[model samples]
Target: MTISFSDLPIRDEFRGMTPYGAPQAPLPVALNVNENTHPIPDDVATDIVDSVSLAVRDLNRYPDREFSLLREAFAGYLGHGLSAENVWAANGSNEVLQHILQAFAGPDRTVMGFGPTYSMYPLLTQATGAQWFAGERGPDFSLTAASAVAQVEEVNPNVILLCAPNNPTGTPLPLDVIAAVYDATDGIVVVDEAYFEFAPHDAPSALTLLDGRPRLVVSRTMSKAFAFAGARVGYLAADPAFIDALRLVRLPYHLSSLTQVAALAALRHADTMLATVDNIVEQRDRISATLTALGYRPYESWTNFVLFGGVADPQATFLALYERGILIRDVGIPGHMRVSAGTEEETTAFLDALASLEF
Candidate 1:
């Protein structure tokens, strides 16, 4: 094997590291991954189990190759005027993101995203040897049109990403702010609405804007609000051009029969899941108020989790929660933890844990 092709200029970044499991599963309380904390209702559970059982029978056959039915159903759910041509999916939104980058980005170009946002964005860019730009966000974690406009002029990237109702802090981007960024950049702009179900008033999803700006793309997931994290189903809606870019990079028959069936079941129970989203919204605010009452400064969240400024060390608190059989992510470095909003009972358990802390 020529000693692993040492003479070639193969990528050096991944060569020394063994692949590790995603920091997504097997944790106590499992809140670190920001999953929906509710279990599926009996009827919805039956739908999934039954659908998957039927799908399993087709195991020897290839997947739909395009996952057409799943895409169509997803379009109908989000109310984004989504079409099959404007939709693409993968094992998860993470993989959908990778497909976009693989098709649109290259070693000679760049990708830009805001700071204190998703941890995976920068990592994903680096995987392709693309220059990753971290445009700074305001101290409050919202993007200003002026700031974003200025950064676009400087970064001159091929793609720009905005995680509306973003991860960690959950601050949603305003629509006018998104329009301003679109006006300033000729490159692709992705508005990640991973938490849209919890964000009714923050901003109308950029999905509807696809008519005005063909460069716009909106990504949504069943993982968060639909309680389908384990099913690995995520969808993206965009202008046909952007959607085609994703298609170019997606593997043939990538979405398994397993994921497609599970998502169909979730869609069938959309109203029931929306009810769960209502409960999650209530729990999130309740947790926020409780966090403030306990002297922690929690951000105005539009997602299911709360990001709080605590008096204790983040690593120490993470360990404490871990020892106590609960888990939350100590994200973007020390002193901050992104704790998911669970059921009222789970929220109470987290509140109790916080109350027991000395600082």
Candidate 2:
């Protein structure tokens, strides 16, 4: 007899939970999931293969538990006066965040984020046995300093999550607001800059704010900007103490030799790896502009994706796009949906499909 998941001795809180993920249908012109969608340049691919080959000889031994060289490479990439001592790496930003929660938050603690933010923030908090709650965003998904401070004051959570170029909305937060929130909360303040490279040129990184604030942690991921989503490398910059805290919680040799080598190879070719960022930005603007012209309300996007509102029927529109061999995300936010900027041809297909729709 087949045992249902419900019949297993799972924790009551997890009895009916579904893992967080977007639909993964194999369709042409796929624009969901906020992936880079650009193929790795040939030179980068070759470099990755060569680097991995070098690591193959040492596979029998444990990989670098410290990941020292990899940490230096990442610190150099982040470059806001960061050193390897201030950096920590994990399989992805999600795991990086998990390490943080494991270190700072648990049972009696609470974590808070602005509403309609990244879905994983709450899920990750739950996994740590912490209470997760949401503060509301202003009209147009805007997060203001005043509003952020009010939420921090009200909740007084042990940890606070702020996402720049926030997921599902594509809105970047102002540093002033982050500072305000930081001032209000004595606990850990995490600024998730997963889409930092996609933000406007004038936007500043939270890394610059790290010096005086030992409790501030800025998390980033190579999956988005470096176009190495397949490599699953993510990292963060914070006070050396914070990095040390994460070290205690992370498993020994968690980063595989192959992952380390692949990430190092990509960082070495950083220019080539990030060469398409500009193009993706252009596509993002095009999507926002064209959507606006089509009488849809597309939020100002600082990321590779746009979250647009005023769809008459998001599910129907989503299914229609799927039928036309294109796929976009519904994001389950009322009449709004999000779509990632794909290659030019793929992006054009998505726009053309939307243009063809009668509603």
Q: TM-score for all predictions?
A: 0.92, 0.98
- Tens digits of lDDT, candidate 2, 168-227: 898889889988888888999999999999987888998888989999999999999788
lDDT of 2 at 123: 92
**Clash totals for all candidate models:** 0, 0
Q: By TM-score, how accurate is candidate 2?
A: 0.98
What is the lDDT of every predicted structure here?
0.82, 0.92
Q: After superposition on all CA atoms, what RMSD does each candidate show versus the true structure?
A: 2.9, 0.9
Query: Of the candidates shown, which would achieve the greatest lDDT relative to the real structure?
Result: 2
Worst 10 residues of 1 by lDDT: 16-25
Candidate 1 colliding pairs: none
